[model samples]
Target: MNIILAIILLVILPYVGFWKLFEKAGRPGWEGIVPLYNAYVMIKLCGRPTWWFILVLIPGLNILVFIGILVDFVKSYGKFSLLDHILAVALPFIYLPKWGFDKNTKYIGASATAPFREKYKIALKKTATREWADAIIFAVIAATLIRTLFIEAYVIPSASMESSLLIGDYLFVSKVNYGARLPMTPVAFPFAHHTMPLIGTKAYWDGVELPYYRLPGLSDIKKGDVVVFNYPMDADSPLYRPVDKRENYIKRCQGTPGDTLSVVDAQVFINGKAAPTPPHGEMSYTVQSDGSEINPQLINDLHLEDLAPGINNTFTVNTTLASVNALKGYSNIKSIVPTLSPKGMEDPLYPVYPVKFPNYKITPNFPKFTWNLDNYGPIIVPKKGWTVKLDSLTFPVYGRAIEIYEGNKVQVQGTDILINGKKADSYTFKMNYYFMMGDNRHNSEDSRFWGFVPEDHIVGKALFIWMSMDDNASFLNKIRWSRLFNIIH
Candidate 1:
């Protein structure tokens, strides 16, 4: 259906407009019907370099080239109004056919005015308000196009990625890294994400939703990459959000498709081997210091935060490896060890499939598998086309993926598993899934609290920190000079 529409818009409509416009410009009307050659002829008519046709092959760059061609083409017809240029680029089918078929519209050629702006000087100089409105409108359109299809600015709002990314850090997320997702909900308030600020109302309307689609990207996601994705569970809220409009979250990709992920004593393991941790990844530690208190300057120098005094000269701190190692050098500090949950401790953890879907339960043979934030999974991340045998015990692990994420009605009747009302023992995944965790292990409520991140929920890759400010610091000291323009690893 979409393919047919594209053909009509890009080929049929353009062919019709170009055919009439070509006759007005004294070019052979049939040349406008030729696919690639039509663009070449149009470029030639506009007095642009013929080599620009090469740029039209590139995705994002092609939009700019087409806009330039259309603007010049309209100018060739002596239509120099800002509205004319907008219509030439936005609705060339309507603008071109009207100008070409209408007897009054004449081809003034390129030398009518030295500058395009000079041709509309009288009308443009008439009102400052009109000029300001045109500038703002053009600026919004250009910025919106660039932001939706290329790169967008984002700011860290939570300490989830602390130590690697801090609160108040401004980042540029690259859409081309994992491919830019076409907006599922296209109509929305300008520059607002999820909700409109202050008003706390939805920024977008659910009407006219499009299917999930992505353009070609530079590369696929790799392990240890800091990725931004929409919160998958946000749809569970009372006021549902479209896939792309869910809360944006940034975390490190710990497990890719098909990899089994687990955490033992707060240490992540993938496929039975220990996964590589980020250099600045951190965890909460219980530090036992001597009766004498540690100097506030030393604590400040180590960049430690959330320092809480524990009983008997013990202190709990969330810090990076370098800071932990530096603290260990002090003879007064007895030990610094990870704050691990006791083994066999089964408190509520992620997915909570059994609770969410009461029909499913752990098989007696599995010894009621207990998991915690510190000691989690061994669960396999679902891969596209991978089939898994479903049973009582395995259901809790993959139930959400099969039912909610994959959009299937799943249930357990007696000992048999029913998917979409069919008695099936196995199911194949439709899309690849990822497991994301923050660098601040204990502090982050990440995949361990939720399940896998579906492919459609992916947003972009965090490229770099353009600015960093400390919220707690004075105005003069707020800017973090060293972190400015720092590349996000």
Candidate 2:
């Protein structure tokens, strides 16, 4: 389910009531069923040059061209009400047929012609209602374009990037920072993402998908950029979606394309060099107290995940290093140490992805990996044109990416690998890939669990926090006033 030439959807809509419309216009009704010819006939019926329909293929001009043709066609049939024009695009199947089949609705002439417009100028005069409607429509379109091509507002929905990006933090993401990805699912409802509100149906139609394309960016996605991207796994939802319509996920890019990334004892390393950890990044730690019940207020004040009771006044909690150091000064706190899963140790609470295989025999036929959340790969991020040999070891690491993300049919049979029905020893990546991980290391479901995020899944770079709210706080203290307009690191 990808692109369909784009024009077929907004312009031709041939399978709709175009046949009846064409017949009423003194043109062969069958012409309405043809592809490009139908669109040409539409422009011709609107008294527009047939060649003007070519603008329908042009990205920026397409919407204008469609609107013009729609307005002209409707006006030709004496349908001039604002509601009529709105439904002409919003519910074209119903409106087009209603207009086409109605005996009273007759084509006056080419309503877009200069002579017709001059004659109807007084009739087209805007009422106060029409003036407001036009202004609001223009505003909606302008805002939509700005949000699509420049920046968009996003709210942090989870504590995955807590301490850095808190839940309820509203931020502006800059599409220009890493290039604005053109909509792959183009025919979606305004302001609605994948799902319609209340009714819970799909908000988009897959009939008008566009191929992945990006405008030139100010810079490439670099390490440490907080990025909002389409969830590569399609995320928590069971229902699948087109790439751009997939759930938006926010995470720090731990590794960019072509970088070899690894997590050693909870610290990230890129190309054998230790990368700087987020200033307020949190991880699970074992905290032993001096046989005193630690203050519950301290836990809430520090924003620790929770203090799970254990023997000997010890507890496991997730909090930032700064908070851990603050607790060290308290007499009741015995020791605070980060909880790490030793090289061969796997934590039930922090299960790593199967790509980091653990139990397989290390033979030519099988591979073994004991990687865990706290200790992960030296896996290479796939760059465009980068090819890697596929085998037992690499299959688990990159197979899903090669097959699903890159679109291929893969099969394995007794030591032989088949891609697209042919034997393939290697695969060259069609797009660059990224490795994303959240600030809350142990508690985050991230690239460590899934795998690489394809370039097409990128949305934008989070620019700054515009507003922040504390949902658990009292009404008077709800606003996180200090964080407003703070630039995202």
Candidate 3:
């Protein structure tokens, strides 16, 4: 409704202002009411060639051309002040009506001899401060629009996707791949994610929240695509954040909507078939070595992260496939084996069943389901309009989705489930959900730790690494030259 009102004001106010302006310029006042023809009249008023009309139809380029036209339009009225030009571009509806209807303002004929730079200089000479302010305001508006709708730069802060995406790697995420989500929390500090940078307070207000909506994009999110999204469980904290304002997380999409996902012996399977893994995916392994301590040079050469020393000189290391293969060729290494969680053994898992409220105690029946990180279920990812029976066994899996993510008051009564105080035998999911896991499989705190990520939380697709840096390296060696500008898989 707010968006509709905004659009109406934008259209009606400009139309009325332009209609009056048309009369002052000796053109028919009704011409402004006619949609595309008004633009043609506007182009003629700016003294530009008719071919320039086609340039205004383009997206990004049109903004510059339109701004130029508006500047010239204001100058054509003999108002050459920097403030007037800024107001014309930034608040066109308000300024246009003022300039058009006010008896004092007059239309000075377009100066064909004066160059654009000379006219801009005449307008800006006395109002340097206003000119600078206008430039900053326009730059911020343009950057925010591009960031929200097209592509955004992101920095990797954790080692969860190590080997593939290193700490301090700067990425350009493409919103066009998975579609750009409209701002749910519209009022936020520009460039700040969840919290204020220096003060560390909440960066956005929930006063004017909007429903989740996305603009159509180039493609749908497919399996194996690296994705960035808001952390679903971040809202469990005392300071609640809206969907778009929650902490951002980057991970590989392991399961798509409607897919049944499971992990057996640390291997993922989607719909009864072994899922394809990323070429650079990694996991932890226990490596037994001779009594002597391993050489630090060898560790550096293989780019291995030594987790900790195990019993009898065995070291648990987080390493990539190439590092593991290189370590296997050493004679002194006794054995190397993957650290896999045993089946039929229950461990702390996500979406802890029957825990209705946030930060509540785990129900006693949670142990009935024997699922671990490595040996998870053939559980289904929720799809829009897909129905699933609500039972004790399935309640734990979908409870968070139904109650928290989808916004309902869900309760499990004796052999019955109630949503919003009414009995519900099944639930047709309102939004699709995705399963996300990091490329560094064993070390990641991802979907396995929390739960499924709803479509509303998705941000964009990882596009490329514009810059990469290693903090642990010396100053001269910090920048990773090879990874710079590399396309993200």
- Candidate 3: worst 10 consecutive residues by lDDT? 352-361
Scored by lDDT, the top model is 2
Q: Which stretches of candidate 2 lie over 4 Å from their true place?
A: 1-118, 235-237, 295-297, 347-365
lDDT of candidate 1? 0.80
lDDT of 1 by residue, 4-63 (tens): 554565467767877887888898889989866887877877767778899888877776
Q: What is the TM-score of each candidate against the true structure?
A: 0.80, 0.80, 0.80
| Tens-digit lDDT string for candidate 3 (110-136) | 632256446656543556687687688
Clashes of each: 0, 0, 0
TM-score of 2: 0.80
Among residues 3 or more apart in sequence or in different chains, the pairs in candidate 2 whose N, CA or C atoms overlap within 3 Å are none
The superposed Cα distance between candidate 1 and the true structure at residue 76, in angstroms, equals 8.2
Residue 364, model 2: lDDT of 56
Candidate 1 at 228: error in angstroms? 1.3
